[model samples]
Target: MKIPFSLPVIDADVIAEMHDTLTNTGWLTSGPKVQALEKELELFIGGGNALCVNSWTSGAMLVLRWFGVGPGDEVIIPSYTYSATALCVMNLGATPVMVDVKEDLTIDANKMRMAVTSKTKAVIPVDLGGYPCDYDAIKEVVNAPEIKELFISDNEKQEMLGRILILSDSAHSLGATYKGVPCGLVSDVTVFSFHSVKNITTGEGGGIVVNLPEPFDNAKELAFLRVLSLNGQNKSAFEKNQIGGWKYDIIDQGLKINMPDLCATVGLAQIRKYKNELLPDRKKIYNYYVDALSSYNWAIIPPFKEGSTESSYHLFLLRISDISEEQRDEMIRVISEKEVGVNVHYIPMPMLTLFKNKGYKMADYPVTYDLYKNEISLPVYNGLTEEKLHFVVDTVVAAYKTISGN
Candidate 1:
């Protein structure tokens, strides 16, 4: 009766696809199936060019590197997110200026504006726990004429600098929506994770979706950048096979982060089931959790902002109001003892040892810290049967009552 936080729901189709990929002719890397998955992701997530990568971390790093974010530049990110969100910025030798999160656990747009300075090159807003951030608010902050001018030396340079990019860490929100537009379309550049726990499964894969303004050929630029990111090779496995195209050039220094066709096959199967099949099942579990916990005054349910109907429902993050961090830990322990495994969504990035050693003060982000202290991620994947779902909910209620002395 052990219910884990999140588990990949795979079946015969996923196994069959993977087996077929293993038996297929092309298997080196980035073959026809990889390209096809990229195209399908682009179409599935609406208008944007999708580039498959080995991981979302690589996708974020590639996008930042392609956009000229480097040493002496600063990228603003929420303190309340997985380390990968900030690690990508650090990987480029750039600074990650941590910002606070609002009560809803998404980055606070106003704080993001205050964190901007001459060195600030981009703003990365994370869709924490599958909830879409206020994209319009973030865009307005990044697109402000005053903010744009601050990054450049003069009006002439301002025009040359281009608008500050909104690179979204949409790892948790592939199917999420904001104001009728999909989450992937909300930011200038969005990266989605297809890890075992994400809405879709690619074994271990991710994709980058870009939406840029004119004067920038994001698709072509990103395509070349993807090549550079993979190995700096002029041609991928698919391209090298073309008649007389075997020999290619190594254009720039790059990292090895290309998705194989075997992974893409799993992605293809998962993507097909995402819209019509898997999503509804997740939504059902989410509603059940909400309905079961509706009467608890201490429960602060995850927000599904108004006008946002297409959430991936990746994780159900429940915040225990007025609870200390120690109590939260104890509650998790109690739940685990009952065989209903629960976990925390994340610890604030600033609280991590690396950031703390680098002089990132956690007290600066009180709201973000508050959310981190109380947050608990409940089980909400496709594998949960109706009986197990109810058992998880009941265990949570029992744990809360025991911990709070209610």
Candidate 2:
């Protein structure tokens, strides 16, 4: 039996809705479906304005651009995160200061604080493997007096200038919670991915949730920025159909990154069915893996903190104890041979050629390297049947035993 690593859950309802949306609506790009999806997402994630985009990378770029994080600015990010996290900063001609990860594989808040300087503008903390980072701790460090003094020269301006924005990469944690507050509301700006492989599928889509500090008309600002980000157009395709609304302006040079209605149609259906219908299945598979793999002395299960009831359960990352990177790779190969699909979460950013060429050193991010060497992402999707789940778990155990020569 072949057990796939990840499979998206799509139902007849989703297909029917998508077909109706495509057939009934002539305007596919940024139409009623997109608007409806955004509104529904806002309600689902509690209160905060959401701007749907073509991809999470584009959303991150737009957020960074909106915050005036450009040339000569630096954004601190975890070394263990996806390349897009740092790529967004580099794309803006800003420096990406890679920091170490904690034992749990989230960004090290202390190291993040240490990485801050006069040029430091924001910190992008990733919810690695759907585990929530200590946002309160990160906020405290970002708001420290000493750190503030270094960034803000004037005592009066310290409050405003010294503050570092928390741009959460919540691509893996759409339904996750931190101390009763949803992930969308926990950060200054949170970006979520709706890729085919994500907990929620929209084929390939993402959105940005803005939780602004002041009452700056976030809805209006987000709407305008989204329009500008897509094509620098003053009016969207929807607005063009309005009587005498075709006349619009191009404010700034921007990229084409708007989410289409087709994608939004799928997203809307997923949001409605996610919590009650899909999440439980994912949790069941995760619990089964945890229970089956617990007895292995070499396996370290993913962390689940107390009171985190709404975890997205995006990936089940397991760490191998006392194993070299080569042995870990070999273990994954062995698992594949057994027809159990397993993959590594990521390689540290510094190890990549692009980052290494930019003078990023792997030696500076020891903790992230340690985690990367031992980590393997197991299958945990909504459609895993009982037979497939058992096969995956048993195959994992067998691979570990074979690699350890037990």
Candidate 3:
């Protein structure tokens, strides 16, 4: 029996929703379904204005672009996160100042504070492994008088906020919460991915919840971003289809990153069952992994919740204590040979070829590499049979035992 790493939560409801969207919904691209998805997401995360986009990268890039992140501008990000976080900054011709992460794999708040500079436009903190970062601490860093003073606003959007933008890369943390509040409400703007492997899947889509503080109207900003996502055209295809609505003008040089109704359909369908059914089910699996593995001498189970912060149960990142990078690789080989698929959450950005050649030294981020070397992400998706779950646990145990000879 081959146990895969992760799977999209595609049940009957998802299929039915997609069918209705493709066949019944007259507007396919960025229409009613997308609007409904945005509304549902907004309400689900409590009350931030959520906007659906083509992808997480697009949504985040739109935020960076709105803030006028360009050549000479620096955006702080954790070296432990996915490449998209840094790629969004680099794609916009801005520099990504990488920092180490905490034990929980979330960006280190102190490291982030030190990375802020006069040219710093934004800080993208990644909620790695479906867990929310220490948002309260991160907020303090960005809200500090020194950090605010160091920020130089070059665009109207930045000037309006008058501080460093905290654009959360919450790709793994939609249902996650910190301080009893959802991820969206903690950051200035939180971007969630609906990639197949994420907690929520929309084939390929993203949602952005705007929570920019006072003196800045979030609704107005959301409206402007909608136009920006539609390629500078003031009128969308759905709007233009209406009577005499074809007459529109190019507002600015914008991007084509609007979410289609079809993709939004899946996200909406899944979200309807998220809080009560889906999230709890994943959390059950995460808890089971922790409970079953906690007693082992070599196993180092990652925390799902600390203080008031809780994970969305995205990935069960179980670390093998006292293991070298090479031993971890060997353990993975043994697990794979047993047909139980496992994966590393990430190979820290600095260790990657793209960043390594660009002067990003892995040694600089010690915490990130320390976690990366021994970590192994297990599958935590919907519809894992009881048998499969036990099989996975047994396989991992045997693999580790085989490698450790204990």
Candidate 4:
């Protein structure tokens, strides 16, 4: 039986919604469905204003750009995350300072605090594999007087945070929580991905959640981001469709990255079933793997539930204890040969050619390197059955033993 790493969960309801959206909605790009999705997400998350976008990359870019993180400014990020976390900073002419993450794969708060300088404009803590970073601890560090004094404020956004902006790279953690609060509400700003591999999908989409506390108006921030998402147009296509609303103004030189109604259709459908079916099913599969693999002393299962926060159970980041990098690769190969697919979450940014050429050294981040060497992301999706879950665990255990010559 061939069990692939991950698959999108789409049922008849999703298909029917997309069909209805296409057939009924005349204003396709950023129309009623998109507006409805924004509202629905806001309600689902319990607070914060939601802005849907074409991708998490673009949503992050918008946040950095809005915060005036540009030329000579430094944005700190975990070295273990996808390159987009660093690349977004680079695209804005800002420098990305790669930092090490903790054993749990979240960004280290102490390292993050120490990394802050007068030039540091923001710090993006990635929720890798749908597990939230320790936002409470990170917040205390951000709020520290010493760190607060180093902030260089040039805009309203910078003024509000009073220090480095904590923009959460929550691409893997939409339904997650941190300290009992929803993922979106924990950070000053949070970005979530709705890509096909994610727990919820719009084929390809993302969302920005504004948690910037009042005195800072979230609605105004949402409007500003909407302008930035649509090539700086004062009015969107849907707005312009209104009678005598054709005339509009170009406010800022923004890029085009708004989520269309077609994507929103899927998002709307998915959000409805997310809590009741999607999350619960994924949790079951995650537990199944945990139960099946618990006896293996070599297996280091990821923590989905810790304290009050719970992961969305998106990716199962399993690590092989005492296994060398070479042996881990061989294990993956053997598992694939047996028709059980396996994959890695990431290769550290400093190890990548792009960031390496830019003068980053992997040697600086020992923990990130160690985590990457043995980490494997197992398949955990909505449609995965108990049988496939058991098969995957059995295959992985056998492959590891075989590769280790045990």
- TM-scores for the candidates: 0.96, 0.95, 0.98, 0.98
Q: Which residue pairs in model 4 clash with each other? A: none
Q: Give all candidate RMSDs, comma-separated.
A: 2.1, 2.3, 1.1, 1.1
Candidate 2: residue pairs that collide = none
- Tens digits of per-residue lDDT, candidate 3, 1-406, equal 9889888887899899988987887778888899888988988998989889989999999988887889999999999988999999999999999999998888899999888889888899898888888887888988899889888878788888889889999999999988799989998999999998888888999998999999889998888888889888888889998888889989988999999888888888999999999999999889889888888878898878977789999989999999999999999999999888799989888888999999999999999999999999998998887789899999999988888888
* Model 1 clashing residue pairs (backbone): none
Model 2: per-residue lDDT, tens digit, 32-103? Answer: 888888888898888999989989998999888777788888899999999999999999999999889898
Return model 3's CA RMSD, one decimal.
1.1
What is the lDDT of every predicted structure here? 0.84, 0.85, 0.89, 0.90
lDDT of 4 by residue, 1-406 (tens): 9998878867898899888887887767798988888888888899899999999999999999988889999999999999999989999999998889999999999998888889999999999999999888888988899888888898877887677788999999988988798899998999999998898888889999988866788889889999989999999999899999899999998989999998888888888889888899899888998988888899999979888899989999999999889988999999999898789989999889988898999999999999999988899988887788778888898898898888
Count of steric clashes across candidates, in order? 0, 0, 0, 0
> How far off is residue 316 in model 1, in Å?
0.5
The better candidate by lDDT, 1 or 4, is 4
Clashing pairs in 3: none
